[model samples]
Structure formats: structure tokens, C-alpha cells
Target: MIACLRLFSALCLAALLAACASSPSSSLGELPRTPDATIEQLLEQATSAKTPEHAALLRLSAADMAFQQNNPARSAQILAQVPLDSLKPAAQIFASTLTAELAMGRNQPKAALAALSHPSLQNLKELPPEQQIRTGTVHARAYEADGQTLAAARERVAMAPLLTGDAAASNHEAIWSLIAAVPGEQLQASGNPVLDGWITLAQAIKNAGTLEQQQAAIDTWRAQNPAHPAAVQLPTPLTRLKELASQPLNKIALLLPQQGPLASVAKALREGFMAAHYQAQQAGQKPPVIEVYDSSRVSSLDEFYKKAQADGVQLVIGPLEKPLVKQLSARPQLPITTLALNYSEGDQAPAQLFQFGLAAEDEAREVSRRARADGLHRAAAMVPKGEWGERVLKAFRQDWEANGGTLIGVEYVDQPVALAQQIADLFKLRQSEGRAKSLQSTVGADVAAQPSRRQDIEFIFLAVTPQQAQQIKPTLNFQYAGDVPVYATSHVFSASGDKNQYNDMNGIMFCETPWLLNTTDPLRNQVTAQWPQANGSLGRLYAMGVDAYRLAPRLGQLKALPDTRIDGLSGNLGMSPSQRIERQMPWAKFVSGQIERLPDTPR
Candidate 1:
């Protein structure tokens, strides 16, 4: 009898041990219910499962819910014990994604970024376009948290092409491109605003009447707050900014100040506009009667519009000054389609007025996105002091944070600030933004964990012109560029100051439009071949002409039905179903003096 009791005790001990040895850490004993689940219940059930795979899957299921409930630490701990190899591809992706979220929640952005970059998570790309975008964003955020800004930024740039196919569909390309202009760590309880905006617009595209109406609809939704997208660059135009690339020409107005103080700038614009006008006639495109509105003659835009109405003009372009454009916003009920040119002054163009100019805000935002995407998180901008610096810095700060990055600081070349003050400010911005940890700490533990000496900083965005850029590029090489890639804005393209600026310009990347590409497209080829003989800004004018001509005859249709968007010479054009022109801004990199298209620009 004593021997029999001993055997029974042995059996009981063996059973307990076997349960603990089972796959998935908790074993089949009353596995605690996931934190959201009764942890006790889950532990019990999980242990009861015979294999680790089963137990891990159950844990994953529970963790997902927990995360949805916003308890990431618990979710992370629960997942830590599970080996996800036994799970299916979709399930594996989920597990990896959840792990990343947990890491992020723990304030270990680097860990989250690393987890998202894991080979196992690559399978997440197999998910739907929407899901890929959603998952990719989380992964990007993790990189941002880990101080891997460029990787996060690249994920965003790549996303625009992915979310919206190269071909224009209800202007998805433009919307995605705009949204991608901002990048950063993904902590949004909802989701990335750019992705959300495109998805919402994509869903509503079929039902909307015109691009104008669609934009108005988007704006209306945004006003309510709940449905607002999580993206910084709202596919503001939500449709193509071009209205006339494919249509017949009727009558188009050139709105530059053909007779003012800024006459040279206006003349540059006019020359380009007229060259495009002649090109249209030469291209067998129905030529629209080109009318010159001496913006100089009109004391105010209010009077200008009244005259425009009297002339039966179908399309209006320009107002080059900020004050003039701002006035139009108050009286936007013009009978024609207005494509107003943009300027630096503090002008808020009307919803109906499409403004096109290289505003500092746009340049800063573009540089931030590109640099961050390329994996350069540490950025030190050197700008002309005062308003320009302030303007660029404001955008840089906003966009840098939005992209999940911190500015290393700003170096003001402005005279009043004093050289010492500027230098002090520069180092101060760097130190304050946590550059200490970044410089001293390893870039990636996993990367370093491996036996390799490969260290590269993705891209650096320098917002300086040819002169300032020339002055600064050497310092970056000697003091900063150390194996780190550099990036710049269109201003970098400004002519050489004093000497061979382009020669001095090396190792910088920038963005531009389709016009710069050496494409086989007949229209592009024509411009490429003829540009040498024409004026300096000839190509830009041709683009304007092509776009304007397409829009001129269609003004009536555009105003009547504001939802329709189309392709144009510049790129895919759309309007926020609200009448504002939308554009898919493509970017390029400048190596030496030549600009090369990035791998992700829309075809």
C-alpha cells in the first residue's frame, strides 16, 4: 500500500512538470487571462494547450485585444514569452506589430523600431495596401523613437506611391504625396493622418461630384474634428492641381504684375507663360486667346475680378503679390476658374484660388520629409537670419516633429544675431533635442550586435541657397558629413555665387518636378531639347502654359462640376472637391550637379 501511494505522487509531479514544459511560456495550466482577459483564466487555458504554438497563438489573440484596450506593457510582457514561428504569416505579422507597439509604449522607441524592422515583420508587406500602410507607419514611428529618422522618412516617401498607384485615381497620388511630406513616430491613437485622408477620399471618390465638392466635403469633415485625418500634409487639393492639360483652350488670363516694382519677377513669369502659350499653338493644341491683365492697372483685386467677369475670361492665373491674393479670398464667387500664383507675403488665398509658388513653408516641409525618409534624423539648418530664418525654422520644427524627428538646431547666418550667438544657438538646439544620447549611443544595437563597421546617416536636408550652401557644405564635410549623406532644397539650385557653386556642391539630395526628368514622353522631350535656346525659366513657363491651356476652356465645366480632376503637364492634378488645385509633388536627388529621380517617384 505504501508503494502504491508513492507511485501516484510521482505521476502527479510528472503531470505538473509536463504542463510547464509545453510550448508558449505559460503552459496549459490555468494560463492567466490576458490582462484584458482574466489573466488567471488565460494561464489555465494556455497551459492546457499541448503545444507552444497553440499557447502562443492564444496569447497573441489576447494581447491584440489588450493593446486595443491601450495596455501595451501587459501585452508586451505576454508576447515576450511566445515564439511566433508556429503562427501563420498574417498572425506572425500581427504578433510582430503588437510587439513593436508594446516597445513603443514602454518609451523604448529604438526597440520598437528594431522590432518593426525584424525579418519576421517583413511578411507584413503581404497584407493589403491599407494594412501595409497602417503597419508600415507603426514601423516608421518605432524608428523615429529609436532616433532612426531617415528610415522612418523613407517609409513615408515609399508609402505615397504605394497607397495611391502612379496613375491618377481620384487624385490619390497627390493626396498621398502631400501626406508623406510629414513623417515621425506613430503614437496616434487613431492612425497616420495622410493614410487616413487618402483612404477616406478613396472611399468617397466614387460618390463625389467634382474635385471641388470633394475638397469641401473633406474640409467639412475636418471641421467636425472626429473624421479629421491624422496626416500633416492633408491631400489639401485632394485632386489634381491641373485643370487644362487634356482639354481644349478657350481663354486664359496671365495675372502677374506686368507693370510693377517686381516687374522682373513678373516678366519672368510672363515670358514663361507666353512661351507655353506659343508652344501650345505649335503643339496642335487648340490655342486659347491669351489676355494680359496689367495687375499694375488694378488698384485692388476686387476691381480686377470685376473686370475679369466683364471680359468673359474663362480662367485666371496670378496676382504674384500676397496682399492681392489675400483679397480674393473674401470674394471667391468669381465666374471663372482662378489659378493664382503664390508669393512670400502673408496672403491667404481663397479656397477657389489655386496658389502655386515655392513658399518657405512648403520648402521646409519637403526637406524635412525627404531627409527624415532617407534616415537622417539629425538636422542643423543654417538660414538667413530674421523673417526668413523664422519662417523656415517654424516649418522645420513643425515638420521635423511631425516626422518623428528633432531638430539638431538652427544656425542663423543673419548679421544682427552675431556670429557667437548663432553658433551658440546651433549647439544648444542640438544638445536640447537629445543629440547627446544620439551621438554617444550606438545607432542600432542589432546592427552593432552583428560583426560589421557599416555606419551611415541616410540624408541631411540643408535649406540654403547657392551662396550660403557653398559656405556651409565644407563645414558639413569637415565637421558634420562624416559618412553621413546630405540633402538640400530647390534653393540649392540657385546659380553659383562668386564662383563654381555647383562644383563646390557635392553629396546633397533635392526634389523637383517631372519637368527635370529625361523622359521619353514627347512633351517632355520637346521641352528638354528646346530649353537650351530659350530663356532661363523657359521650361517652367511651358509647364504653366500646358496646364493653363488645358484649364482655360474647361473653366465653365470646372465651376459647374468641381469634382472632376485630371492629369496635367506638371504632374497628377486634383482639386479638393473644393476648387483648390491639388498636386502630387515629386522629389529628386542632386548628385554633383545632376538631379536623379528617387526610386519611389510616381511613374
Candidate 2:
């Protein structure tokens, strides 16, 4: 029983405890200490003992004692049974406050707020100033959790005038900050002015500080309010968020070029998606009934969407063409997540559509990230001079710049670079400097002295064919390029595994998709079984069609990544915040013309 006749309110209350308490811990660490309860304590305060006030207070005391015994469920049960009619005005307020606190302890923020709304609970004016403040402060937290920001703020403003400071003042401000839509820097001063001053002082360090400054403020806030919810328990994602299978399937339309030039490929993908429904049925999940709209069937894509929406299709996936994806996404057909098979036409990602293509730019960034991590800070590019080649070149430049690496110079070569000749041309000037300095430095030492600049050629980016990469990369073994790393794109990966053709590609890296590798998955094996016979990589695209179908309805989850992180039929993926897929270059080096991984790249 703490007495409270104070001038300032206890504005620094620690809230958000509800968010923390519900986080599931893998293990219950240990049992807490036990306490002895004396029945005599209940009898000691028996003044007008038969009254509601006396009864409610006694029940509250018993409930608290149960809570102290590590039995929260029992404590809440006891509080609920307490008779409220006999409670005096002060006792009634205390009883309701305790009710809300019990809800908080039980991790029921919504219920806690509901409990505060009780008529007896809401009539805080009849209670002592301090008790009213404590009740209102906690009630505000419930409102915040329910997404009622205005109500929470209103509660704070109304109750701030009632509190007086105590050991609990620090507890109040932490809660206030969480539910606040805007910073409470200015308004905090009006509440329990003493604690308000402390919070105001905190504002100086919290306003748009550097990363270090922000971290320090976070640490300070935690230290001052150890029990604050966000401090002790983080907002961990509940992976058990009910999966889509349990949900009613939204009508998702499939738009593919099933009747056009890629009709065979499109049909293959349609079957792959059909396989998904079969798999879902086997798993006892509701299957989505897909309505396939052949892009070749409709003269206009806008009609495809119009028909689908008229038929109640809520989602759409496919139409691999970039132009169609742009038109469909500009105005979404429904409140659905549509996935396109190409890059967004512009930087503004469509709210209704997302891109799932294996974007070339994404591969470049991955290559650059790996290069820097390998301590390859300086790079050069020998790229082709066409639409595809120039695109790869642009990707390389952007990736290098964004990653703090410098591009010394990029040479355009339409044919496979004369590996030895290009290496000689690039390094001839540096070599000439050495020859000129022969008189100043030891000739043997100069010969032994690999120029520091030579070592700076940490890596090389060559936009060429597997045959080209293979032909040129090995020539480097005897040249300066041999000492530097080499990187490329899927173009190099597309070679037909001609061992003799790629004999020189023993140590070159490139990006690839998951389908590029034949997985042990029976579906993958079955679809591409003849690939080995034809000695072709066409089966990989076949599998892409198959995998696409299985992933279609799940388009909402697949391409909708929150960051440059995505997981696709390709590899572990990155996604833009707008939920577009961002894939990486799965690096592989040629091992005897059969792709093998370098030591650092994952197998």
C-alpha cells in the first residue's frame, strides 16, 4: 500500500509490456521464489468488512498475493469474482485499475482497455488523484494496441493532470512514447512535470541522431524502464500467421502466352501450376480453381482483366511480356496481388503488380557485393556493345558504384576479347613504367616486384559467352588477368556444357537460377528428363514453367518481399520494399566445362 499525495503526475509509466509478455520463449528458464500468505492479513483490514469496498479490496489483495505466487491465471480469476457493489469510490477505482493490470499481465491489451471502460472504472473523478492517473495511463496502452491512437492520446491528456510522481514515474513516459502518433517531446512536460522534465531532456539525444546516437538512446530508455514491453520483449514475428491454405482462396487469374509462339512452354507452366492444386488436395488444403486466360486468345490484355474481374477473379499472375505487365499493373483489377514476369517499367512499383523476373541489375549487385567482401576493391569491365551487352555493362557500373568499388575503365568488345591481347593492352602502360624505372630500382627486385597497381586489379567483369569466357579466361593464366578474379552473367551459364569449348573457364564466376541446376525433386527430374538426351538446357525453362504454376496463387507471398530479399525458383532472393523480387547471381565457376563452385561461393 503505497501512499500518494503528490504535486506532479507519475508521467513516466512503462507500457508496451503487453507486446513483450506474449512473445513465446522456447524454454521456461526456472521457477520463481514462493511466498507465504497469511489469512490474518485479509482480516486485519475488515472495517465495514461486509461492504463492497471492503470485499473488493480484500479480493484485490488476495489476487495480488496469488500473482506474487506465480499464478497469474488464478489471480485474474480471483479479481473477476470480487464484488464491486460494496466498493467505496477509492476502492472501486483501485479495483478497476487492478483489473486492467491483470489483463496486461495476461497479455490481453484489448481486454485491459475494455475493462477500463467500465462505468465504475471510467468514473475516475471520484477516486484519489494518483489512483485515477495510474488507471488511465494503463488504459491508454490498451487503446494503442487496438489501433485507436486517438483514444490513447486522449486518455494521456485527460489523465496527465491527475498523476503525482513516485518510483513509477519512469514507467509512464515509456508507455506514452509507444502509443504516441507523434513524438511527445513537447507535451510530456505537462504531465507529472517532474518525470516530464526527464523525458524532455531525453528528446535532445533522440531527434534524428546518428546510428550510434540512436542506439545509445535506446539503451538509456531500456535501463530506465527495464520492464517496459519493447525493452524486455521484442516484436518478434509469429511465423504461424495462418498460411493461405487455411484461408478462402481469392480468385486468381492465370495469364500466360499459352497459345502463341511460346504455347508449348506456356502449357508446360500451366500444368506445373495444376500440379500445385493436386499437391494442395493431397495435403488436405483448399485448392484454388484457376481460370487460365491465354494472352494469345485475347486481342487486348485489358479485356483479360475485365473478364476476370467480372467473373470475380481477385488476383492475376503472368503475361511475361513487359508491356502487358505495365498495362495490367497501372490500374489493378482487384484488391489482389498481381505478379509480373518482367521488371517494372519505371521506378514507381505498381501497388497492384510486382516483378518476378531474374533481373539483370540484381545479378550485378550480387557480383559486386561478393567482390568487395573478397577484398577486390578495384575492377574493370570488358563488355559487349549491344542492347543485352550494354545492359549488363550498365548493371556492372551501377553495382560497382553503389557498393563503393571503382571501375577503372570499361572496354567494349563485340567479339570474345583476345584474352592475352586485352590483358597486355591494359597492363602494357604499367609495365612500361617498370621498364623506365629499371635504373632507379634493382632490376631483380623490379622483376620480383609485382607493381602495387597490378595487385589492385582485384577482379575483372567480362560480358561474353561461355565459349568466350572459357577461351579468354584461361589465357590469363600466363598473363596479368590470371592473377585477378573474373565475373560474368547467365549468358556464360547458357553454354551447352561443351567440355572442350569451356576448357578454359575453370575459374570464372557467373549468376544462374535454381532451375539451371537439376534438383532431385521428382517433378524437376520428370520435366527435364530428356535434357540429358538432347544435351540441351531447354529443360530448365520447362521446369520454370512448372514451378511458376505451383507458386502462382502464392504470388502474394512470393514476389512480395519487403526488402531486396526474395526467395524464388532461382535462389535465395532479395525484394524491394514494394514487394518486387530481387534475385542474386548464384556464383559458379566452370569446373571442367561442367559448372563447379569456387571455394567461397556456396555449393
Candidate 3:
């Protein structure tokens, strides 16, 4: 694990090297030109500097070198010694940018943004183009980390004129990535011609009917805006898209169990996949011919693949059972590209096998991301007492700690009768009561003292059922923890449309599928019109099924371009290295017996 982390850190430093242009020699101020100087030599020079400004410059250079060497701790230590308010404007900007970079390394994007906002940055343009590019790139990265996609794209767009050669080419690709990441609804005309042109180009490709039509749209966009930077040289993803257009998926086989414990699940998935297929047909786009195979009836996996290949199946989109997926994952290779509907336990997956699922782990990780984004660093958890809960807690802990959050307390929730005591124990309310008694005894009389829960807990990470959540929320209020924020997984919501039920869950924020939240989604509306149960908790499975269909043709697109995301009913979907599909869900809170969708940042 340590070796893997070292490899990851090395890759990260290599990626950031493009933005690490050398500091202008003029900022060094009479210091010997020792471009090859070690960190010790730089700090030694700083200690003997005659002027404070020169000392700050030396420290800044040392910090930059430390960061380049992947020693963020040493970089942060050196940066802390440089008194920013006492430094010259140029040195101040240099220090501030370096500070931002270090903060970002710590997963504190808000802190990074604050560092970059130093007043000294107003004179950034006066610095050399290298410094400007370095500063702008860091600023863009901070915005991206903070979930301000438009701001990040705009920053990159502003840096375009100042960039050239490999730097310019890289920034051009980055700008498109940031813009493409923006949801279709948020991709608006910013009224800046250059940014607006790029926005329109993304919208044109997104809204185009077919791959051929998308290629045509790109060609037309370039023709209409010949002066646009993207027109001069298309982003690499677009170049890949042009190649994908000629080789379309011609046929698909959806492998699922027709009769088993998961038959009902298979039904929902099939309906959802067909719903998307019919939608494409209705929209005048020619979707590939689809064949459904009942895996439960198949005697052999080899025979199944032999039939599929004989039938000219280019893509296989299921085997919703975990055991079946595990079987496929153990193979050296698959005869056809398979998008498994469920994920297996281990990381070893064949090159042709891609896993996608509606795993609760995704929601747990989403809670961590949202909680940290809300500035809640200290967390307590309440999850059901079972293996499912263990999995969720594991996912949350891994992501939460990795993002610099502290999980201070946890309670394995069991019976409803035990909830009040569990809540009290989690909040240290019993200790508070014990302290109150001690105070009364010391005073030798009755003293008025209200029990106070631990103030260290900033929020609660909750993973429970709808009924359990209904009981848990009011129990927390009874235990004096109602005021503390609660970040919950989607399990807490049943989509029952019961105002009284929702009122019980009031003040609890949860991540949920866009299908349940977006009442007006055309596909969702149509699907629910036919299968009303799609309006309930079952809707998430249906949404996952819809995403599976959307993912089938674009799997190659996603594999080739690692950053590509498909906004689907389930979530904002991306691919992991193991070919598992990861979802970033939208968040919503219960307010006044209604579910209120929230902005990416905390309210």
C-alpha cells in the first residue's frame, strides 16, 4: 500500500510539473544562480540574507523545490516562516501561490482559494508570463477542486493568450475538460466571446443526435468560429470522438437472470434499458439492435459467449448477479465487451469486463465529499448493525480520512429501543451528565446544569433505512443532537411522498439519484408513466439500468478519455481504473416536508 501511494504521489507530481514554471530570476535578488541548489543550501542562504525581502524570496524558492520533490510537509513548513505581509508584492504573490499549492495537496481547496486571494495577486499580470501561467493554473485547479467548474474553465480561458507550445496545448485540452464536466443545464453563454464559443461547442456536441451528427456539429462549429482557439486545434477528446463516429456499435446482448431471486430486479433493469432504447428510437436516432439472454437458463459461460459472438454481438450489458460477474471477472479475456450490471469483490477484472452497479458505497463516499465541502472536519457516524453497514462505514472512512476529515465517534445502530442511549453515547451526553453531577456534589447543593453533548462532532454520517431514519432523527432531537448536521446515504429516503415521513427526516441532508429528484426528466416521466413503481425506491435500480444502456456505447469513449463523464438518471458517472463505474450523486435536504435540491456547495 505504501509503494502504491508513492507511485500515486509521483504521478501527481509529474502531472503538476507543467504548471511549475521556474520563478523569474529577478525575484532572487543578488542570490547566486544555483538552479541546482539543494533545500539545505537555499535555507542556509535565507538565514544569512541582509534584507528580509531576499530572505522571503529564498524561502519561496526552497518551498517550490520542496513541493517539486513531493515533500509537502517541508514545503508547508518553509512557507509558514515567510511573513507574507512583510514581503514585497512580487514575493508575496509567489509565496501566496505556493501556499495555495500546498493547501491543495492537503485536500483543503477552500484554504487554497483563500491563500490565492491575497491582495498581492492584483499585480499578477505584471510578472513574467511564466509566473502568470503558474499562478493562473493553480488558481484554476483550486476552483476545480472547490467544485466551481465554470470558474475553473474561465480561469483557463483567460490564461490562453499568455500560453504557447506544450503549455498552450495542454491548457486547451484542460479548458474543454472543465467545460465538458459542466452539466448541460449549467453550460450557459457567459457573454465572453471566447468562453461562450467554447461553451457553445460543448453544447453542440452534447445535444447532437448521433456520433455522425456530433462530428458534423464540430465541423460546423469550427467553420462558423474559425478564430476560436478550439477551432484552430480541436481538443484531444474531440479528435478521439471523430474516430469513434466511424465505428458504431452495431448489436448488443443484455445478459440477465429471467427466473431467480433477482428476477424482479432483472425485470426493472430490462424495462429501464428498453425505455432508453425506445427513447432513442422516438428521437429518430438508430439505436443498436438489442438481444436479451437469460443467464439463469444458460448451462455454460463459454457456450453463452459462443452464441453471443456467433450472433454478432459487439457489446454485452449485464449478468446482474454478483456470482455471474465474479465468473466473468476471473477470466483472462472475454469474447465480447461486457458491461456487468453488478461488481465483484476483488480488483482483478479482465480487460473486456466492465462493472457498473448501484452500490451503497458510492453514497457513503458522497456523504464524505459533501460533509468536507461543508467545512465539517470532525464527524460521528450512525449506521445499521450489519455487514451492509460495515461496507458503507468502510467506504466513508477511507474517503473521509483521505480528504483530511476526522471520524471521532461511531455507533452501530440496532434496535429502535436502543437508539436514544446510542445517540447519547455517541455525543458523550452521559459524560456531560456525569460532569453535571460532579459540579452539583462539589457545590454541596443542587445546581442547575443542562446536559451538553460533545461539541467536537461537526456532523453525523448516517446509513440507515427510511423507517430507521424516521426513528433515529427524532431520537437525536430527544438526545440534544438535533442541531448537529446529519449527512445521510440515499437509503434514508424511500420516495414514499409521505409528508409526515419526510417531516420526521427534516434537517437531514442526503445524496440521491437525479431520477427521483428531477420530476421533469423526459425519460423518467415516461418510464414512471408506464411503471409507477419507478417513482418509489425501486426507481434507483431503474436509473442504474438506464445508465447501463447509456454506458454501453460510451464505454470505449470513457476508457480512452479517463475524464469523460455521462450525466445519467442515476448520477454523474465515471470509470475507475478497475473498470468499475463510480457515481457522483446530487444532494437534497428534507425541508418543511419537501425534498429541496441543494447546490454543490453546502447551504
Candidate 4:
């Protein structure tokens, strides 16, 4: 089988070289022919081979060729013809591995596992190192297809030490991707010190914003696990971290409406930012100096920004209102980097400006994503009767449809009667009533009738306040639409810690920050103890402030690597190419008058 594979690879290289030479200057329509024809010719030659061993080798080669042609079914069919009993010991193992791979390609994980279950193929350590890694990779993939993420991750981890050079890098990347897909709680519970160490290192790298912090994390991991494989592979990520951490920014200026109608909100944000700063200080890390500026007292943003620049402020964070964010974003040339607290109205934002906020649109988009992930593809939206409701509904609809979900209906109403009427209309309850009325009129007085809700809608997207949600939820149950699951934004729940008030909201699911649901965290407990009065939107804003403080120095690194995510108090933060940072939050469901956190899943 090894000789046959080498021969096949040589033939492919020759064919590729010939094609490239023939099409050196060919036009779009005059390119060289595809290798499918060559593959077919080889298949015919394999069928007519004289020797049995040659025939088996030819069949295996044809199966590999078919796979290269992107025809897994054809490959499996070809592999089925290879006489496994006639091949040598090594050849038999290779043939079985190839068969299993082809079966996996066909999405038949059980068949793949069965192919690898032979006694001769069970002891992979006896095989060559490369073959062992290859076999282990296929097994891991099969496990993943079977929905066994931890098992799959462990399979890769077990093969890690044997990999070297480029293969080692590739294997490490694959392992990280697999582990990253696993939930944090599951990763922590994996009981494998190597996997746990990798997860911890990944989190530390994500949260680190400076070279010293990253080096300290790496050193700490090395100290804890001196012989671990990840300790040796730390240089790869550290190179990128050093590059990002090299950028200089020693001073930051915060602009907030400190003495106006929004003073309480500004105060909460200040406290949150300070909490993060203080935490860094406690960790023996010296962060940049932060100066607070009152936006309400400033005559103009231009003057304030110019003053900050003159004062040698390397970064500016703030202007909590939308108008101020818009005004600052419209500036042609900002002397210093500014992180706006709110997003501008238009899609295009100025350079040197990054927007971060507890935007309703962000939560609405997340609701749609979570709904689709939960297998709810068809949704009916119930929003309040106002601009805010319309905005949230629009965001949900756009994201839902973009993700291949069907928006069955959208209704906006504030009053309970209006909400009930909209729900009835959405579920076609009036049509059921009409049918019942017709049946009653046509039949005698002793007839009975039953009304049914629409079955097409899989879930509901609600954008309403806590009070409105309480009224709407019970009305949905009363209207015979209780079976359909309902998903909402964070607006449906208040952070007042009153479980009894939300008893009516049973079975409703929403997404929110860990700071609200995970009260056991030291930071959360401290924040709650410090500000007992913060609730609902104010609490969310405070959490956002904490994340903002942590994100400031890491923006450069985030832009450098778009796939990297920071676990924040607000949510999991990821950066977009357009400089928009999105938060992926934990999910929660209202059950028995109390909020319960849902298991985190891949987004």
C-alpha cells in the first residue's frame, strides 16, 4: 500500500505539472482538461491488472484518486473492491485506514469506526509515526462527527507529542480549534491536565494586553507544568503578542456626562472601569493613567479632544450619548485614538475610532443567532409599540433572515389587549375561531369545537420590558400557543434580584452577561456589594464599562487576530474587520420564578 500510494502521488504530480505547462498562457476558456478523465482511465487499467496484489494496489490507488476528485461515494465504492485479506500486514492497515477515511467522508461515522475496529488495526503504536498520526486524526474526526467533542479533543492531544515541525504546528492548531469548540465548563471538567493547561493558557493569552502580562502568563504556565507539550509551543503565539504589545499608549482620557441627567449612569460606568483598574493593580500590573473628562461641561468635542491631545493623552474613551459618538466619529482626523461608547448612525465610521456599547441591536442580533442554533428556524416577533421596539425588531429580522431563518410575522403593541390580539393574529387563532363558528352553525346545539394555533412557527422573538413580557407570556399560554418556545433580548429580565416578579416569565429564554447570573464570581460579588442599587440597564452598562477598560489596550491585538476572543465580564468579545466588537453572552432561561443559566454552546 505504501508503494502504491507513492506511485499514485507521483502520477498526480506529473499530471498537475503537465496541466500547468499546457495552460501556461491559455485563455479562460482554453484551459487544460480536468484529471477526472485521467482518473477514469486509471480505474479501467486497475480492473484489468493481471496479478492479484497489483489489482489490489490499483483498486486502492483508484479509491484515493476518486477521493481527490471530490467524489467520496465513488471513493468508497472503489475502496470496497480492494481485497484486504491479500495485502501485506502494513498494506492491510493502510487499506483499512483509507477505507475508514472514505466512510467518514460519506458521513457514515459508524462505518468508519467499524472499519478501524479490526484487531490488526487496533494497536496504532505498531504503525509508523506518520501513519499513527493520520489514523488518530481520522479517529478524532469520527468522534467529532459522533458529537463526542471531549473524546475527539483527547484523541488529538494523545497524538500531540509525536508530531514535529510543520506537522506539529498543524496538529496544535487543529487541537486548539477542537478544544475551543468545547464549552469552558466541559474543558475544565475534562480531567486531563494537558488539556486543562492549554485552555488556561488560551484564556490567559486572550486576556493579556501587554508583553509583560503575556510573558508572565507563559512563565506561570511553565512553572506549573514544566514538562507539558504546550510549554514548548508557547513561542508561536508569544511572537504575535510581542508585536501587538509593542505599540505605545501611556495615558487614557475618559469623557462622560458627570453632572447632568445621565450622571448616575456615568457614575456607574466610572465605578466599573475603576474596578477593572483596581483589579489590575491588585495583580501587580501597572496600567496606563486614566483621567475623567465631563462631556456635559465641555463646550465642544473638538476642543476637548484637542485639549486631550495637548495633555499627551494617548487614548480617549467616552461620550456616552449617541449624538456625541456620532459627532466624534465624523471628525476627519483625530489626533489620538478614541473608543466611542456608542456606535454612529451610519455604517461607515472614521479611522482611529472604535465603538463599544450595550447596544440593543447587538442583543437582538444575538437572540436571532441563539434561536437559530437551538433549531428554531421560523420565528414570530412581538415588540413593544415604539421606536426602541422597532429598532430591536428590525435588527432581529435582518440577522435572522441573513442566517437562513424565516420571519413568520412581526407585531408591535404596548397594551395587553393589543398584544393578545397580535398573538392571536400571529397564530391564526381568529381563523380557528371562524372554523369553530362555522361548525357550530352547521351542526346541532350539542356539538363541541376546539381551536388550534399555527404549527409553522417554531419560536417567538420578543422585544419588550419586564412588565410587558410578564403580561405577554401568560397571554401566549392563554391563547393556546404555549408549546412554541419564546426567545427574547436582555430587556425581558430585570437585574433587581426579585425572583417572584418573573414567575410569570417561566419557560422564556434570553441571553445576558455573566455578571447578572453568575453571582459567585468575586468581581461580580464585589460589584454588587459596592452598588446594591444598580439593576436592569444600569447594571449592564456597568459591565460594559468593565469590558471597555479591559479592551482598550487589547484593541490592536484583536484587530491583528480577528478570530481571537476575550472572555469579558460583559460577554465573549470578538473583533470584526470593520472595528466592531461583538459580545457573545451566556444564555439563561426563566424557570419556576427563578433564572437559570443554560449550558454554553458554540456560536
**Local distance difference test scores for all models:** 0.56, 0.58, 0.88, 0.77
Q: Candidate 1 vs. truth: CA RMSD? A: 15.7
Best of the two (1, 3) by lDDT: 3
> Between prediction 2 and prediction 4, which has the larger lDDT?
4
Candidate 3 residues lying further than 4 Å off, grouped into runs, are 1-168, 183-196, 203-216, 245-247, 258-264, 275-285, 294-307, 323-337, 344-354, 365-380, 394-408, 415-417, 427-461, 466-543, 550-603
Q: Would you list the clashing residue pairs of candidate 4?
A: none
RMSD of each: 15.7, 21.1, 11.0, 10.2
lDDT of 1 at 584: 45
Per-residue lDDT for 569 in model 4?
80
Error of 4 at 345 (Å): 1.1
Error of 4 at 542 (Å): 1.7
lDDT tens readout by residue for model 3, 141-219 = 9999999999999999988999879988899989988888776778888989999999999888778755677789999
Give the CA lDDT, 0 to 100, for residue 523 in model 3: 94
Model 2 earns a TM-score of: 0.54
Q: Judged by lDDT against the true structure, how good is candidate 1?
A: 0.56
lDDT of 4 by residue, 329-401 (tens): 7777677878888788776777788888877888898888788777778988988888888888889889999
Please identify model 4 stretches exceeding 4 Å from their true place.
1-243, 535-537
Q: Which wins on TM-score, candidate 1 or candidate 3?
A: 3
Lowest-scoring 10 consecutive residues by lDDT in candidate 3? Answer: 25-34
lDDT by residue (tens digit), candidate 2, 174-280:
44443322333343554544344334334533352233343455556668766544445322110111233234555668888866567765665565556555656
Candidate with top lDDT is 3
1 against 2, candidate with superior lDDT: 2
lDDT pick, better of 3 and 4? 3
Total clashes for model 1: 65
